[model samples]
Target: MNIDTIAKMLFFATVRIENHGAKSASVGTGFIMTASLENGDQCPMLVTNKHVLAGAQQLVAHFIPRKPEANVPDLGQAVAVDLPPTMYVGHPDPTVDIAVMPLAPTLLLLANKLFIQALPLSLLATELPDLYTDAIEEITFVGYPNGHRDPMNFTPIARRGITATPLQLDFGGKPMFLVDGSVFGGSSGSPVFLFNQGTYRSGPNVITAGSRIALVGIIAQTMLRNAQLPVAEEVAATAHVKFAQELNIGIAFNAKAIKESIELMVSSAGQHLATAATGDGVTELSPA
Candidate 1:
């Protein structure tokens, strides 16, 4: 598959986790990465923003596949699915916004059963060229907004945007690309990709060129302007009417931080796999 196709697959893995009981909501996106199992065998792992899964006792991921043939029924329905029992969360580093979830054979099988294709783990280490080298780089962001339900309405919407700055900046110490596109509260964990300029298969598999997409960074936070008041009542008591301006904001993340998190997860997962391989009769599976 080409970059666009791969991007869609990445979006499918992105999920919206809700915790009404906890009175909080967050957005998270994940992609398959390679890791080792207890038997010292390598397996696929899921990686996403740490904040997305923070403090949740339960989690569910919704995946939407490329639409079926024109004759197929339910052409645009969103598909709701769950990760497998073998999935395990890696130690989270709050400093950086990332987390790794190890996937067991059962999870891979479950993904296969659901017809959700996992992106090649090799892409994690592939170096993305600096967007600064070019005046503009075409990109796309994918994620679930507002804990929305699934076929998330005919596959995740691919929003097109261009990098606005020649040089990228660190967002809270994570790699980030400044784009002209507007993202909202629920877009925190969206994966931003550089469009690949290449060919693709025809039909429902139509792959557009000049659209090579690379996982450059994950959406973390958007910059906003707010009045600094000692208290809400202070501004109100000063004889000023309550009003605020909503301006176009900026999104940021530390590129190096994200890279480090991914590397740590990959490295730690390998060790876990080796430990599992010893087979002392200890189950590595985390209870769902």
Candidate 2:
């Protein structure tokens, strides 16, 4: 896709996710990813943080409908798909907060009813170009903050920040990095990207005049700091603690973790496909 199309497509790449529990409801973000299979099949999957769906009795994904004539989103014509919790498959490693859900079945049901622009797996940055340690690239993350989004347009809020830590090294001995931005509760599962158009530096003293984009990571946690509590004039026996203040730094799991999570889902589906092909106690399986 051209740079302008790609940039515009990024706006539709994410869906505002609402987690509904028996007693309460919460919100977060989720993005669609198109994973290519070895069998020449393309599977669309919804990617998000595991915690976003935790304790969710029903998950609702808000999607924009397509205008048949224009083949573009119909803005105000938004549709929501309420799904059971069983549809989500989380990372095998409990520590890995990534979760993925196959979108083929859902799309098949919705059929030409919705307009979704999925981010291709090619956008995942598995490796970085040669760069020195001093390089600090600009990053952009798309999501809803504080459960806020354009209710009429169904568009997410895009925020920009810089890498607070080196992408080459795992931050805090984990497969994650830090970003300096205004991250909030509902921003979890936001896809962090590196998008440079027109011109970019390929190496030291080298400027390349081309467009570049990559899915660098996914937001998981926001850093916080406890503030000192003030003493009461009455000097009560105990004082209630206030909520921690946001440090405006976000913790994002790197692209490799996302690739691994998608692979896990794909491999599981592939195994089922192989079994079905053999006609050996195999049942019809949907993409995982």
Show the lowest summed lDDT stretch of 10 residues, model 2.
279-288
lDDT against true structure, model 2: 0.79
Query: Which numbered prediction scores highest in TM-score against the true structure?
Result: 2
Give lDDT tens digits, candidate 2, residues 1-288: 122356677778899999998899999999998866767677889999999999988999988887776567788768899866767778887987899888898888785877777877766776333322234779899998998888877788999999999877789888889999999999999999877778766657877776667788999989999886766857755575456888999999988899888878887776221111111111111111
lDDT of 1 at 192: 66
For model 2, the stretches where C-alpha displacement exceeds 4 angstroms are 1-4, 127-135, 229-241, 271-288
lDDT of each: 0.49, 0.79
- Per-residue lDDT value at 279 in model 2: 18
lDDT of 1 by residue, 57-135 (tens): 5566654433343222232454455544224453355555666666564365454333344443323313433222244
**What RMSD does model 1 have?**
10.1
Model 2: per-residue Cα lDDT at residue 245: 86
Cα misplacement distance, residue 83 of candidate 1 (Å): 5.8
**Count of backbone clashes for each model?**
25, 0
Can you give the lDDT of residue 101 in candidate 2?
88
| Model 2 residue 79 CA deviation in Å | 0.5
